[model samples]
Target: MRRKEKLVTVQLTGLTHKGESVGRTEEGVVVFVQGGVPGDKAIVSLARKRKGVWNGFVKEILTESQNRVIPVCQHFNYCGGCSWQNLSYPAQLALKEKVVIDSLTRIAKVSVNSLEPILACNQEYYYRNKLEFTFSNRRWLLPEELQNDVIDVNKNALGFHRPGTFDKIVDISQCHLQIDLSNQIRNSLKNYCLSNNLSFYDVKNHVGFLRNLIIKTNENEQALVLISFSEDNQSEIQSIFSFLKNNFPQICSAYYAINTKKNDSWFDLQCIKVYGEDYLLTNLHHAKYCIGPKSFFQTNRLQAEQLYALVKKYAEFQGHENVYDLYCGVGSIGIYLADQVKNVIGIEEIPEAIDDAKINAKLNNLTNCSFLTGDVKALLNDELKSKFGAPDVVIVDPPRVGIHPDVIAEIINFAPMKIIYVSCNPSTAARDFALFDEAYQIERLRPVDMFPMTNHIELVSILIRR
Candidate 1:
């Protein structure tokens, strides 16, 4: 007869992709706990069981890990933003390096010759250039509040969603992710809405005035604020925008959109500018980029410079190579390297991003760069090669899901002399690397820590055609 276990105390030895700690039972059954760190001996209550795997939550900390430190953020546990805040910075980098190596070795079955050390960020906190906060009518209550029977707390929250709960939000007093002004803007807006009797969005019923707030800052200290409203109230919208413009003089641009759809996505909805310019400016080395409302730019501006440096170093451009940049958003990478390359062609699926890319190229005064709007898998064919000239080098900075297999096939068919891949997700990158194992040999692998105090890591891989 098999033994049925209720609650088990196990020793955690490893970490997972989503920052969960891994442990095993005496029977060698793997268990995952959210708050467990490596070298932690904790009492966990198994909450879920499936097949041979078990999931648990930490009930009590029997023995804390050496790498564990007191998280600085007050909203560390409840907020879904940063999970590894308890772990030290050095420890986080080490674990991220291990994650990359493990995924490549285990999932891709490819042996990397040289795995360089992770490039740590100089500014860990307040490194993000962009942050999005949701306005929720249902606020998640703290354990202490529930126990003390505190019912006078304000129910409206303008902050991040609670972990594993979509409708509930944790009211954030301060967020260490973005600049301090972000907190000021969000809190002020929340107060203004409350005072003015403005209705915050209820995700369940989808009825409210305020839907979502997006804040972005550039290297020049210029700020852009974009708000989404579920209902069309021009008076309220103008009042809020005017208040922001008058109070926060740093906010150079302000835009608003009315999104009545069940979802909060404002990509398809038209945004109307109420103040200042329509776009914010960002720079990478010598190249300047104009970031529009829907443009996709790297959230970590400083680390992005280092990441692109590695990409340029690995590509080894000699001013005569024709380069093709796939999944190019705003032409940041391509424009940065255009001066050193013969000519560059960038392809992106989003039309707005392509427009920004073209505008950025023109702003940089690079006549050798061309931006095209289309699906890469459908665009990279014999005709494209004939029109744009065969690429001497190809650079791919794909999404977290990695590139489509058909797109990989097309790249292989084109057979560029060199391929530089920049990925935010290691597992998907490893899987994609496996597809190129037959034709390309891995030359260099460099991991860049774009996001500190979190489990997310970025990597740049250089492969040469065999």
Candidate 2:
């Protein structure tokens, strides 16, 4: 237990919220292993310690976990995209569910009468609807590549960023998260850029033509590719767009954005439609949405359907109730539940998201749903309640920070009969649930697996007034 910066054998027993594997020393001191799984005995380097807890990473797996399996991807060892790909699918689900239960029991000090089983995703791989890849001049070479006798000088990469490095990117050839079409599109683009002598972005120097590429798809099998360029070369942009349009006729739309900013956050960046349609059609159950290039929809489409179904089930709507969807990005949940509820008034802070929400609502021909753009903390007030009658039910699918404290208080003041809470982070959810403990009682809770191959857990809880 006193070991630090030295090799020591440890047994990984659980998984942390940040996706690190949990292990312990012989003296019962906890050690977080980066690439370890439960039932695996491994040599760890306790490189850092904080708040009396040890943090380390696996040096070698002395004994493999029974649940561990061979990763499907060749770059799984170094790629930051997946954390639990080494563990079996069933084992991953079990660990996630355990994390939720542990968080709620310890942080919220609450338990449900009906702890419904965690919902498993039907499609484990290729379930994601969207993926954002970065372009870097300096690529992180794979272990096998480094072992080769002849060292390749090509360092340009167009894929995911390395886990711990900011400027290094893993040159992904075949990512298992999205459909094979995405792979084909990505590999083709990379090949075209490399052959045409296009410069990949240099994060440190802010030089290069290609910056990022986001490939998105809908359940309808339509595809959209949005490329970001650090330099606005009109001729090059036109040529690239034309190449994609001609080569990939299956793509419904293709857009490009010129982002010269130092940071690569392109959510607010304006994108120009260079080819095909303006938007792609994404359908969830009966709700159909017009997904723009920058719209913030759930990454996993099929699992989102399952997750929303759990939300509806927890809502237990009676066909005449008014609902409030706080933090309603793109208003997909509100639109999905519009038919069951008398009215759904959603409030969000992002203007573009609200715009997308309005368009989606119009596309669905839903008159019962309305979306407003503003701070949820400031907008969920009595004036709003007067304008739109008090929400009979509040369905909150908040960001990872969970709902704000003021918003939580306002929901308590409103005293809805039922609250359907959908959360992406379990630790924050447990803390916020504790805030509502006095006003409501937990009737049931179920964890939904919106993301696989990672340690993120989505939970849906049904709270009834005491």
Candidate 3:
């Protein structure tokens, strides 16, 4: 016989990397509770062990945390995008700050002399410049709809994937992360598809015509859309594109792709443009970025500008320093600091990002900035340094895994006077700080809440040569 279900009452006190609340029982057995606030006393069900820790959700809240607040989105209970929305914005900032401090003290085991307060974002919602939606035939039923209700004949969904479920998606009526235009366009497309009998993608069998929709909005109030279809059906594609143009004039450009592959990865696929303009434009301070269909740019515009300002202030550019931007995707940071520096040389692995970087530099009429496309670890050598000159200030914005140890050794060998490290993962950043202990010392560190209502954070630290 199957074992009987067991329940535990846990006092949720902290957070995990995925935004679940961390709690403990009387015996100090740790519990990760979903739908839990930091200070909530909740009865957690679905109690199951996974890799030695208990994972569950709050079945009943005996006591509410002071930091708890009403979530703005109706689907907050189930949607995975904004798990911290129920927690107050101030509380969210505090939690992120705690992540940094804990990682440094426990993991890095280094004492930072100065750590600034977390910089809160201006907007709590609608701060994202881009959003991607998937089309799935398996839709996750709502709590109310599952109570002795029959499954509807229609099984169409066009929204985010349900948490922990790869095949099923939650049909979103409204999303709060992007502008209202995004909402209208998404809803209109879903309705039109259902009415016109265009089938949604079947993840299990890899059958159907509709696959995905991506919407990118800009500070200039123009929108760009990309539709991914399972196969190339020209007549149907034109009909859909025509419908979009007739309904939403804000869509300045549109593109569609034919993806016959099983996976949703589109970087290798070709995207055909059937609309106006080649890219979207975003003005970041003095630099105007041309964000193409596949280019990577900062999602939060307001906070990105503030973060760049911090980079400039921390570098303390003297107008005669040669700067090296390592892993600089699209050269956003390097180009922004071009005017204040003698010359800036950027290195990145992706050729497309480097192409965009060069385009952006030329667009801004910046002769001092140049970009190279190659693996940072392979390219940061004596030959490259001799060609571009030794860096006075080194700026690195690596992936979440942080800089590899080999790359760290090379940066130390360069022996730049100043180092600026921008990180998205605090834990990895802490690990990296430990590696840099001997050569450089962290002068000052600041955390920016680039993604509000979520646990994701960005931090910029200035390191001085010891």
lDDT of 3 by residue, 1-466 (tens): 5567677888888898999999997678898888999999988886588999989988888999999998999888777889998899999998899889988899988775579999999999999999999999988888677765767646789999988888989989899999989999999999999999999999999999999999999986789999999989999999999999999999998999999999998798798999988888898898889888888899998899999999999999999999999999999999999999999999999999999999999999999998999999899999998999999999999999999999999999999999999999999998998898799999999999999988898999998999
Clashes of 2: 0
How far out, in Å, is residue 55 in model 2? 5.1
Q: Of the candidates numbered 2 and 3, which has the greater lDDT value?
A: 3
Instruction: State the lDDT of candidate 2 residue by residue for 340-384, as single tens digits.
Output: 989999999999999999999999999988899999899998999
Show pairs that collide, candidate 3: none
Candidate order by decreasing lDDT: 3, 1, 2
> What lDDT is obtained when candidate 3 is compared to the true structure?
0.91
Scored against the true structure, residue 59 in model 3 reaches a CA lDDT of 84
Please, what is the TM-score per model? 0.96, 0.95, 0.97
After TM-score superposition, the amount by which residue 88's alpha carbon in candidate 3 deviates from its true location, in angstroms, is 0.9
Count the clashes in each prediction.
0, 0, 0
Model 1, 53-135: lDDT tens digits are 78887878899999998889999878969889888899999999999999889988988666788899999899998988899
Candidate 1 ranges with C-alpha deviation above 4 Å: 1-7, 25-29, 49-52
